[model samples]
Structures are given as structure tokens and as C-alpha cells.
Target: MDPRISKQRTALVLDQPFFGVLALRLKVVEDASCKTFWTDGESLGYNPAYLGGLNDLETRGVLAHEVLHVANGHCWRQGDRDPKLWNDACDYAINPIVLEAGMLLPKGVLVDTRFKGKSAEEIYGILAQEKRQKEKQQKQQGKGKQDGSKPDAQSWQQSASQPKQQPDSTPGGSSAPQSSNANGANTPSANPEPTATPDAAPSCGEVRQYTGDDKALKEADWKVAVLQAAKAAKMRGALPGALEAMATDAVEPVVDWRPILHRFAQESSPTDYSFAMPNRRYLHMGLYLPSLNEPAVGDAVFVRDSSGSVWDETQAQFAAEIIAVNAGVQPRRLIVMDCNTRVTQVQIFERGDAVELDLLPVRGGGGTSFVEPFERLEKEGIRPAFLVYLTDMDGPFPDEAPDYPVLWASTTPLKRARKAPFGEMVEVIC
Candidate 1:
């Protein structure tokens, strides 16, 4: 069994109060393999990731969450994933549990910080900031009653210098939210900038995704070499040498695999059952940010600097590029990085469903270091044919963008930088 995934299929059935019940077969999987529904049976499938890690508490929590999904009939929800319906379901099912479990959350559940536009830490920071802002307003209002005028931003900031209070909850079936004093708890919430424009911490980046499984690429060097050579030629405005390199015997070898596959499968299928056909399709996963209305092909990379903050811009622009392979195109692949200019992770987005843009890590709101994207694009083996970014262009970037043809689109006004890189620049309302 793969280290990242081991599962036991359950035989349990469904009932009225619990949408379904399941039998247990224990399996072990890698930290990474938790992405899919590793456990499946007649009634429903469960994602072990929900359990985060397999401690007793997490195991129970995951089991409970899955039970909730079954009970709510989320498995049978007719339509696809959309923000509204999904959020509503989470409110009904997830919130109550989280509120009740406030302090003793399972260790692994929240570890993988990937959300729509903010990192786990960044999102938490947003919560902290809101709390402080509210407290400031309360004190300012109290002073205003003694004098005359009302509280303002400055008064609120002054009040923020003081200590703060905290809320508590108990974990039974559901913890009833206690009504606290409005003088401190409510305080009119500082009017909140009209329609409560969200103070987004931000989310960012799509890892470089290759089209084929790693093993397939290893067995198909010639095909992949040809593809890479073509891209190099286009990028450098020269083709003859690259073409010659592609035609070489070693790096571009084409070996038939009929015998090799028979050796591996051990028991061959009946000749009549063996049938196949082939065509060309491709996909590239880049920076997938909700801030943009388009697609992306930029890898999420960390940068080098004093602060060591991972940069994830939701709005970036790309021109002169687009889809050219399946997310699992055997020949292409995605790369990843962290904030300290070190690579933290690299996973291929082979399956269509694996390409998640709304996860917290990529869109986590933070100052993005810009030098990494170009360095990634210029790497020797990469063959991505297009690029796009959704960014506000608010921070530092590399001295030069990659020479490969590119497109630059910014979702927000060029806030702090001259402009982002690309051949074409289009301003978007989103």
C-alpha cells in the first residue's frame, strides 16, 4: 500500500437519524494522500483529511463530520460546488461543532492552512485585528457620553492600547452563545465601512502541475524531450540546436514498453480485453486566485528576504498563453516553494478536482515576494506554454520578468509598484 494512503472499505448502511452508518476498516496513508475520499462503500465516501491526523479525538471528529455530511445529504446535493450553498451547509453543520469544540480542536484538522485568500495564520490575524478594533470603539463611546461627540477611528485606536477580554464555549451537543454586555460586546461594531467590505488577508498561488503521473513521464522521455525542445525554441527565438538536441539518442530515446508492462502487471489481460486509443489534450495549473475571472499557469513559489513572508497575490495577469495539456499531462509538472526561498511542497495537480484555488494557503493575504515567479518560469526543464496572474501589484518583484512570452493582468490598480510583467496588460474590475 502507498505510504500516504491505506484504507479499509466499510460495509455499513444508511438509516434515518444518521444519513448513513459505516463499518470500519483501518488503513494508513501519507500526510499528502489525505486529499481524496480514501474510505468508500455503498452509501458514502469519507475524506481522511477531515480527520487531519488519526488521534482518538481527531478520529472521532472526522467520523462526526462525515456523519454530518451524510445526515445533511451533502453527498446527494445535486449541483456542483458553489460558494453560497457550500457556505450555508458549513454554517449549519460545521460551525456548531467548531463553536462547541472551541479550545480542544484536533491537532491535525487545521494544520493544512489552505483557504480562499488567506493563510491560516493570516486569517487568524484578521480575526485578532477585528477584535481589537471592536474593543477600541467601545472605550471611545464611553468617553463620548461624558463629553459630547461620538467615538472615531483615533479614539478607537487610543482605546486599543488597553487589555482585552475573551469569549468561552463548552463542547456538548451545541454550546449556546452567551449574550455579553453590549457596552463592550456590541458597541455598534464601528459602523464597519458601510456594507462590511471584507478585510481580506488574501489567498494565492497554484502549484506547477504536470500532465502525467511521475512514472509515466519517466518512461516517455522522447515525447517529453520533444515537447520541451519545442518550448525552448520558441522562447529563445531559435530552433535548430534545440531540435538537434531533441533528436539525440539518449535524452530522446523512444523504447516500446509492451514487454515491460507485461513484466509489471504479471498476469496479463486477455488479448480481446486489451484495447486502447490516444489523442492529445493538456492542462497547466498556475496561480489560481479567486480575484481573477480567468485561469492561470504560474507556480506558487516562496521568495528570499528578511521578512520571509510567502507572497500570494489573488490578481495577476498573463497574456499570450493558455491551456495546452491535461492537469496530468505526463510530460509537464508543477513546482512549489515557501516564504524563506525554500521549497516546502511539490504535488502534481493531475486530477481535475485536485486543482483547488480557494484553499487558504494560496490566497492567504500577505505581501507576496515577486522574484520567485520569473525564476520558476525560466527553469531549464519547465515547458509551460502560457501564464496569467491576478495581482494588485503592491510589492517588490524581480529585476526582469522571464523572457518566455507572458501576459500581465492586474485586478487592482497598480497600488505600490510600477506594473507587473507581461506582454499585454488588462485591468479587471474584480
Candidate 2:
């Protein structure tokens, strides 16, 4: 390891342990051929001269920037996208985060305030759209020239004599010029301004594409590493605010809940074989095989929080998912309980009964208490296959875990879901 790099890694371990834990995982190699620094989710390669150019603070920022690319799984997440553009988007998304952690990036590093708090995929879409527009404008300009539409010699000379607007050399600086339409209304110019291109933009580090078949495995490993790093930082009381939310998100990623709900329903429903009911088809073949006894899909309990905190759209989505789950699982009984401080309303849908939200009554506009639904289930002797509680997770949880599986489909921010005493929690986006 280069002495400078080694020194910075130690500094990170002491100051920012979360990033330090991830940074130390990357095997460092001093390569003069590497223009700046780069990480391929495994190793960090840097030019010694480039490392020498940056001051201590800037060098630390560059190191952290490379670690963030790996930590964020940017290398593995670039699926079928333009590699250069994806890397640029990843930089834009990571730079502000690095800056927010109180580190100073080298001059001209990619930093767009618009991309702050956005995922790399989101940033990539914005960058890709801008690139397409720029290409379209260039093509139109080329076609106009071919059509013999040329500027007058005097106008051309005057335009040529005018000083060109220097591209904003500072990171995150806006260079776009505003123009007026026929109605004299000022609007953003259709002509793409000269901003940061891959060649023009000086990145702190590059996110190299992962070319392995085990992209998912690699991504999972990084997520685990991130969690472990977070734990270590928390132990030392050094985790940054930016990293806290990010770490929580890494653990509970935003995913479609339909498939998860289906899986839970399928897994919770019991299946057995009964020797008393011998297979008739096997009996004809002189084989005494036991008959498969699949019981009716058991009761599925859905507890809705009727407290004012839960959004109407969230409730609607919850109802829609419940209906979908019921259709798929075809449960013997679908019990819908609306509760706030106590059970406000209980609607039972027996097998073959239509499950519709529009017909269901919405009740309660009071304080939240999750204990009521569980208490009611125990009192009624209802051993459901699974119970899904749709809430903001703001209320008090049951004192003890229920016998059946519990899935908390919370509409609140992910950080709030951590408060659930017992259950698998998923963020339900409206």
C-alpha cells in the first residue's frame, strides 16, 4: 500500500468508521496508468501523481467517494445502461453525500444539488434524458446547415468576435443560458449548454462496471458489509447523519410488496399427507400411496390503522394488495380489522365472498394502539396464517409476539419501522 493511502485509511477508520470499514475492504493498488482513482467493487486503483496532487482533506474525500460507489452498489446496479453515463450519474449522486459528511472534494468533481438524496438509477434517468435532447439538437443543427440556411457574413463575423461564455469550472455550477420564445416569455433554452461531459468533467473516482454473473450476490455482500460498518460506527458513536438513513434503507430496500405478500401467504398455509385418504390413481397401480391433504387457505388477517397519520392513498393501496392476496391465496376467511385506540370495525369475508374496499366502511379518527387487533385475534381464537398490519408504526406494539407470522406494511419512513417490536416491516409507498 502507498504510505499516503495507508495514512488516509487510518484517518478514515478513526474519524469516519462506517466509510472506513468499507474503504479498508478494497485492495489498494498504485497504478500510474489510472488517471485518478477508481473502484470495481473489489479493488481501488489510483495514480500516485493524482494522489500527490490533492491536499489531505481532498484526498480523504476522493477515498471516501470511491468507497461510497462500492457501498452504494453502483458497480453492480448499472444494468444494460451506457457505462460512462451511469458512472457520471453515480458520481453526481455520491458527491453531495461525500460533501455532506464534511469532506472537501477536489476541484471540478461532479456535484449536482438536484441529484442530492436521489438514487443512482434516478439520477441516470435525468442524465440520459439530457443526453438524448443534446443529441437531437446537434442533429437538427447539422440538418439546418445542410439545407443551405447560413448566417450572413456580417452576423457571423459579429458572433465570432463575441467572447465565448466560459463553462462553469466549479463543481455543481450551472452553465445553462435562458432564452425567450416568440411571446417574449423567458424559458430554458432548447439548445443543450456546455456542462460536464465525461471528458470535460473531472471526477474524484470512477465506478467500474462489474462484469460477473454474481452481481446479486456481490450486491448482497456489500449490503451486509454496510450494515456491519454501520454497527461498528454506532458502537463508537461516529456514524454520520447521512449514513444513518442510508444504512437503514440498505437493510430495507424499496420493493414491490405483492410478491412478498404472495410468498408469505403460500409459506404460512400448512400442507400434509393423510394415509387414511389413499390416492385412488396409485391404488389402481397397486401402490398404497398416501393422499395429499391440502387444507383450505387459512384465515388472513389485515389490520388497518384508522389513525389520522395514515394516508388515504396508503390505505387504498393496502386494500388493493389485500384483495390481490386474497385472490391469489383464496383464504378460507379474510378478516379485515380497522383499529385506532381499539378495534373500530371488523369485516369478515368468508371463502367465495367478494373482497372489495369500496364497500368496506372506514372508521376511527383517534390515537393508535396496535395491541387491540392482536388481543381481539387471541380472544376470538383466530389463528390466522399471517397478519398484516398496515400502519405508520407510530402506535404501541403488542407486549408479546403473536403465534402467527406478522408483516407490518408501514406507510411511514423506514426509520420508524425499526420500532416494531416483532414483525417483518416493509415500507408501503403511496
Candidate 3:
């Protein structure tokens, strides 16, 4: 029996929480391209002879490591970063989490305590800084000429382009059953196993049996699979904290606007005494004195574009968000402004008042200028806790940012295509 298959079976037998069996479904491809073992966050690819040296636990650990790469959405998160450094960061992030699960990894796997609890994005920043420092030191030492040419950093695309192989040809060969005979019975044959045609593509359902690539997992199916896996691991009380965090992040993905709105409203709220509502405690004493209310959100301003690009329904949606934000903090006042090249209509509504858009006038149709709203606020002597601007972001921005936090809710399909000089951006997907 092949040691690779034997050890893999042994590893499965020793599964702490069934990670071995769960991860084994990834297409195991045998190729000499990888020196030891590597995954493109989709499939596990290795040189069979290299992995054959690992013990049963070590082999199982390696399998879990590859599966985790896909489970945690590492491939999808690698946007525009140096691939080698990204890979290193990802390894640093994952290796310790698996090792902590009482699994054994082969020696020389990257593991660093400093990167613990940090997301891959954070680790990538750290690695990028180190790479920059190394480059600077090399320049000071005159390692290269002042010419334009420089040694290239690691490329993610290069690694992503590696050819995938069938499980039968993987590092140690497949443990799957052999082909069925013409009589429809499984049988051993002296002939070589037939290989899939190079140009052949796997069907949708077949993708699960192949590499756990991002394309295969993108259709909201992975969420269901990952949630089930996480639930099983939790039941065994063997899920590592790091893996748990990643699983929670995948299962209940957070939207950008949620936290941004909460923080902005909370931080900008104010406190004051109100004569209208006396303290209930003091009311028992028959005193009609003013009561101190907990700090509530201060005045907040929201600006919208009344241009041809923005529709009434979009304006209504934006108004609803403002209403919600106001309700959350109970702001003293909520000001809504409509503008294009200049301020067209300005309406002020108290916390309990309804915003009637039909009653307010809509102005500006020639061109869009984001500077108009800020100027109008300053001219009207109206100060706000924070400002939120809703637009398609197709206008010229002010030369300088105002002295308040601004949240730009864009209706654009691509959020990254435009940027505000200051403040955060939230995409309106609806």
C-alpha cells in the first residue's frame, strides 16, 4: 500500500472534528510544479514524492491548511497585493490556527505569533512594509544600478495560472476506486488509468469534486457548506478560535454601512436637559423641574443630488436611512438639503417630524458641484454633528474637505471607480 494513502487514511481515523474527511474532497493534483505542497486557495497541488515524507498527522495538517484557504475566502481577498507577500501573510495567518488544533505540520511552515488575531489584510500591510524597507536598504547598499530595471516581487497571477491535475495523478496518487468494467462492476486493470482531456471543463456539480476554486464557491453555495462545517466543528468542541472567527465572518458576512452608520451616530451624539419631560424619579416628589436626558445625537445634515441621474425612489431610500439614523441617536435636528450646481432646496425637520419630499422644491439641472452644499451650510450658519451626501458621485468635489465627517452613499455600480477626498464611502447596491 502507498504510504501516502495509508497515512491519509490514518489521518482520517484520527480526525479531531472531521476536518480530514471534510477537506479530502478538494481535488488532489499531483504535479512537479510545486517543490513541496501549495494550494491556489482552490485545489491542493503537490509533488507526491515530497509529501510522501510527512507523517500521518502532518499530511492531515497539510490537507486542513489547503481546505482552510478556500473556506476563509483568502483567494477572493487578495486584491492588488504582492502575491508572494500575500501568500506569506496568509500562511502566517493560517498555520498557527491549524497547529493549535493539535495537528502536526511539516517543519519550515511559516508561523508567527505577532500576526495572531490579525486579518490577512492587516498582515499584508505588515509584509508590504517589510518589503519596502528591504528595498530601501538594498538601494542604500548599491545592490543594483540606478537603471529602471528592478527585481520583480512575487506575482499572484503567476501562481494562480498553475495547471490543475486530476486526483489520480496527485503527489501520492488517488485513493478513489478504479474505473468500472464494461459489465458495470469495479475491477482492477493492468492498463493505465484514463486521464481527463485537457480542454474538458467540469460541470457545476462536478466542481465540488474538483478543486475548491473561488469560481466554484461564488454562487452562495459555499456559505451553506461552510456553515454546516462550522456547526459540526463546534459540536466537537475542537474548532480553533481563529478558525471560528473566520467561519463566523464567512457565514454572517458584514456589510460596510452597518458599522459605519452606528459609529458615526454614536460618537456625534450630545447630552442636555429638557423641561418638557421631567425626571420620573423627581416626579414622585411632586417637582416639575427639568430632567437630564442621556446624551443624544446632535444636529446631523444630509445632502442629496436632485440631478437627472438620481431618481425619486433613490431619494426616498436615502431619506429613510436619515430617518433611521435620527431615530437611533434622537438627534436634536435633521436637516435635508437638495442640490446640483447650487443649493436648490433646504428643509429642516425635528426628530419626530416626517420629511415631505413632494412639498420641498428640487433644483439644479445644468451641472453637478459638490461644493454647493457645504457653502450653503456655512452661509446659513448651520452646524451639524456629521454630514451624509447621497449621489452617483459624478460631480466635482470641493477643493478642501469640510470640518465634519461625511459619508458618501453612492448609487454607482462600481464603488471603487470614484473616491471622496475625505470621509468614508458606502455603496447603495439597491
**Model number with the top TM-score:** 2
Q: Which model is ahead, 2 or 3, in terms of TM-score?
A: 2
Ranking by lDDT: 2, 3, 1
- Worst 10-residue lDDT window for candidate 1 reads 201-210
Error of 3 at 79 (Å): 2.9
lDDT of 1 by residue, 90-179 (tens): 323332332243212333232211222221223332233444456677886788776666456556787698654211111111111111
**Higher-lDDT candidate of 1 and 2:** 2
For residue 315, model 2's alpha carbon misses the true position, in angstroms, by 27
lDDT of each: 0.31, 0.76, 0.61
- Rate residue 388 of model 3 by lDDT: 85
Model 2 whole-model lDDT (C-alpha atoms): 0.76
lDDT: worst 10-residue window of model 3? 201-210
Clashing pairs in 2: none
After superposition, the stretches of candidate 2 with alpha carbons farther than 4 Å from their true spots are 150-199, 253-430
TM-score of 1: 0.25
Task: Tell me each candidate's TM-score.
Answer: 0.25, 0.53, 0.46
Mark the 10 consecutive residues where model 2 has the least summed lDDT. 166-175
Q: Which residue pairs show collisions in model 3?
A: 30-170, 48-171, 269-297, 270-296
